[model samples]
Target: MNASLFCMAIFSVTLNAVAQIALRKTMLTLGALPSSLITAFSFLTNLIGNFWFLGGMLCYAVSIGAWMIVLSKAEVSAAYPLLSIGYLITAAIGYFFLGEHVNTTRLIGIGIICIGIVVISRSA
Candidate 1:
């Protein structure tokens, strides 16, 4: 991939990762959703005021734009594997920021994902 296209992919993936982390934090604060729309709306309004929700929304907006650019330049099959980069980043953020576990098996899986991304990039 060209430099600009590669940067776009990275931005898309990073934003996606950050968004996942932010959303997870927001959900933890908000707890489970209520069945009633009114209750849900009220909770959402409160939730939106939280930093995590706003940060996630910002990241999501940026990711959408970057992803469109990436899709324009690369085939979906070639580009879709890039999403795993997001997963890896999100897993790290989840573990570090949210105090989630990162067992040996999961670490090994992440290592495999890194190898896959490297292989895919080389193929492109």
Candidate 2:
């Protein structure tokens, strides 16, 4: 990928990661949804009004726009794997900002993902 495309891919993945984090936080706040129809409708209303949920949706929209641009210029075989970078980004953010655990096994999985990303990028 060219510099601009590479940057766009990074931007897309970062936004995607942010979206995941935001949505996770929103869910943590909202807890489980009600099973009853009326209560479920109320829950849906509350979710739509949530700032974090709206922000997450906006991030996803922007990320998809940037991702579309990247796909136009890059091969899917090479470009799609770049989304895996979002896992690393999300895991770090979760550990640092959200007090989420990052255990040894998860760290090893993240390392493997990093290696895969490097290999895929080089292949492109």
Give lDDT tens digits, candidate 2, residues 1-124: 9999999999999999999999998999888978899799888998999999999999999999999999999999999999999989999999998999999999999999999999989998
Which 10-residue window in model 1 sums to the lowest lDDT?
85-94
**How does candidate 1 score on lDDT?**
0.89
| lDDT, each prediction | 0.89, 0.95
* Best prediction by TM-score: 2
RMSD of 1: 1.8
Give one digit per residue, the lDDT tens place, for model 1 in 1-124.
7888888998999998999899888989888887898798889788979898999999999999999999999988788888888878888888989999989999899999999999988887
| TM-score of candidate 1 against the unseen true structure | 0.87
TM per candidate comes to 0.87, 0.96
Positional deviation of 81 in candidate 1, in angstroms? 0.9
Top model number, lDDT: 2
The per-residue C-alpha lDDT of model 2 at residue 20 equals 96
* Prediction 2 TM-score vs. true: 0.96
